[model samples]
Target: MTGSDAAGRLDDDDFPAYTMGRAAELIGTTPAFLRALGEARLIEPLRSVGGHRRYSRYQLRIAARARDLVDEGMAIEAACKIVILQDQLAEAQRINEEMRGTASQESDLPPG
Candidate 1:
């Protein structure tokens, strides 16, 4: 679904707030599993004012994707590596786009 579709389902305030128990429930996984995912750096939960793990909706979605990958017969280690690579690729793409934008701006500038 698109961002608009998700936005229509819940308010913005709903996105940034979830206890570990609630996050596990929302992702259809166990609390222990969610903790393990955090340990493995699969999903990062926000730290509350009291140092509690406050999982956002995005973290729940990451857990769901990890579950899907594991369910598809991928080894957990491999799935984790794939997720890391995907994040790195996205970052690289963003950097490339920014560089292109800068180059385009320079090209549009008049000669000194």
Candidate 2:
């Protein structure tokens, strides 16, 4: 791949650029914690050719949020559930906002 192609991947949140160890370090958590997250079906990391797990920035963000909840004494399963619900709610809100914008634009046009 070209230099620009690789550079663009740096801006891609879904790119699995971090190894398990690095991901754990970046999120200030342990590998076991990450493994537990995987067990909870929170986030699944992509496996490398050699069978090592690799994580993306997006996964790290979710993991970090789960870690926060866990730190607050929440159960792992419950924390994962809450995070999933939060993500769904955010997506729904975004869609609603977009629909509202389209409706408002349509209203500005002449009635036909």
Candidate 3:
């Protein structure tokens, strides 16, 4: 990849730019914690060609939330479930709002 290609990836939140150790350090957690999150199916890191785990900014954010809940005495599995539910709820709400907006626009049109 060229310099421009690498530079642009820095701004891509989904780019798997961080190794497992770096990801753990950035989040102020241990590799074991991140592994647990992966085991729980909360955040699946991409694997490099050599089979090493590579984390994206988006996965790190999810890991951070899981860490927060775990620090508050919640079990890893429970935290994962909550995070999954929260994300699902947010997406559902966004879709509902979009549908509502479309329905209102349709209502505002004259009957055929």
> Highest TM-score, which number?
3
- lDDT digits (tens) for residues 38-112 of candidate 2: 999999999999999999999999999999999999999999999999999999999999999999999999988
lDDT (tens digit, per residue) of candidate 1 on 1-110: 99997876576543558988888888787888777787888877877889888887777777788878887998776777788788899999999999999999999999
Score candidate 1 by lDDT. 0.80
TM-score result, candidate 3: 0.96
Each model's TM-score, in the order given?
0.72, 0.95, 0.96
**Every candidate's lDDT:** 0.80, 0.97, 0.97
Cα deviation at 53, candidate 1, in Å, is 3.7
Model 1, position 110: C-alpha lDDT score:
100
Ordered by TM-score, highest first, the candidates read 3, 2, 1
User: Model 1 clash pairs?
Assistant: none
Give every collision pair in model 2: none
Q: Please, what's the RMSD in Å of model 3?
A: 0.8
Better of 2 and 3 by TM-score: 3
Candidate 3, residue 17: Cα displacement in angstroms equals: 0.6
Q: Which is better, 1 or 2, measured by TM-score?
A: 2
lDDT of 3: 0.97
Better of 1 and 3 by lDDT: 3
